[model samples]
Target: MDQKQVRQRIEEIIDNNAIGILSTVENNKPYARYMTFLNKDKTMYTPTSRETYKVEEIDKNSNVHVLLGYQGEGFGDEYVEVTGTASIRDDKELIEDLWTDELDNWFDGKDDPKLIFLEIKPEYVRLMNGRGEPPHSLDL
Candidate 1:
């Protein structure tokens, strides 16, 4: 598929599955964490704390990877792997707007000063289906 189609598919997949694995590099080693994400205007959002290791790793290296999919038994299943650079935003307005009671699970009901949002703009993505064959990739 073309870049536009790939982007559209990725957006659809992300919209369908709000949870993903966000991977970052720390000390040249891969660090992966599960995150609940929001997508808007081509940007992906996830709440995180500034004091967290993921934040520190992103500060040193903005590169990040995201894996999104559902584990189920059947055909026509979908999955995506997105690679991008992340930016940390501590804007209270944005954070407040994105924050929901559901987010309490991540922050324990305390909106700590160190808590912020991670904005990811994907540079490339690879999409796969249940067939488990070579994935079609798009360069953004």
Candidate 2:
């Protein structure tokens, strides 16, 4: 696939998958957790509490990986492997934009001080197990 096609495929994957496993590194080891992933265009965001290990890990090492598109149910399914840099963003305006009542299940409301978003800016995105056997790299 060409770059545009690959980019579209990735956008579709992220749009179809609501939750994804995000991996962050700590002391060269990987720590991963399921997160409520959100998107704006091609960029992805995941909400997290301030007093969390993931936030600390992001602080230490910004590089992270996100596995999207696969729902953890079947084998040989399609997914997107995203390699990116992450930062803990305390942007209330962005929070208000992505806020949903479903997320209220986690925080004390959108205004909660503990609420924050992990901003992931993808540097390299790989399309896996979709369309063709060849892995396609999509530019960010």
Candidate 3:
């Protein structure tokens, strides 16, 4: 698929899914965790605590992988994988803009200094359709 198509597909997947499995490297080992994410203007946002292991891991190694899709019992086969470098942002305005009641489930309504936002600028993405064989990839 073309760049535009890839972008659109990624947007669609992210829009449909709120949770993603984010993979990061820690202590020279791989770590994966489920996280709620939001996408805006092709950028992925994940709110987390600064004290979280995943946050520390990302600080040590910016390279990260994100998988967003629906995997139900005998359901659709849609999936999207995004690989990129992530950075921690402490901008209060950005954090407030992305904040919602749903986030209270994680941070318990605490937006302290420990609260941080991870901005993932995707460098590559692979999108798969339902029961498809060949997947479409885009390198940005």
Candidate 4:
């Protein structure tokens, strides 16, 4: 697939599965967890608590990975493998902009001091293990 086709597929997958596994480097090892994510333009956003271990991990190593679009069982399941740089932010404007009532289940509303967002800026992405001939590389 070409870059444009891959981009559209990536967006489609992201729209289908808002949840993905976010991997962070911790002590030179990978620690991953399911996270609810959002996208605007081409940037990926995930809300997290400042107190979480991933915050420290991201601080130590900005490089991160996210696996999205996998839902059903087993082989050839469609997904996007995202490799990016991550940064933790406490911007109130951004928090408000990305906030949703569903998130209140974890946070004490938008102004909660612990409320923060992890911004993942993708460097490379791939449409992996799908119904295709080979993995398709994508750039954003």
TM-score to native of every candidate shown: 0.84, 0.93, 0.87, 0.95
Per residue, candidate 4 scores C-alpha lDDT tens digits across 1-140 of 77888888888998888999999988889999999989987889999999999999999999999999987766878899999999988998999899999998999999999999999999998998777548998855
lDDT of 2 at 126: 94
The regions of model 2 sitting more than 4 angstroms off are 72-76
Model 4, position 82, has a per-residue lDDT of 91
Kindly report which residue stretches of model 3 are placed more than 4 angstroms away from their true locations once superposed. Answer: 1-3, 73-76, 108-110
Can you list the residue pairs that collide in candidate 4? none
Compare the candidates by TM-score and give the number of the best one.
4
Task: Find the number of clashing residue pairs for candidate 3.
Answer: 0
Which regions in candidate 4 have their CA more than 4 angstroms from the true location? none
* Index of the highest-lDDT prediction: 4
Worst 10 residues of 4 by lDDT: 131-140
- With candidate 3 superimposed using the best TM-score fit, by how many Å does residue 61's alpha carbon deviate from the native? 0.6
What is the descending TM-score order?
4, 2, 3, 1
Q: What do the candidate models score in CA lDDT, each in turn? A: 0.84, 0.88, 0.85, 0.90
Which regions of candidate 1 are displaced past 4 Å? 2-4, 72-76, 108-111, 130-133
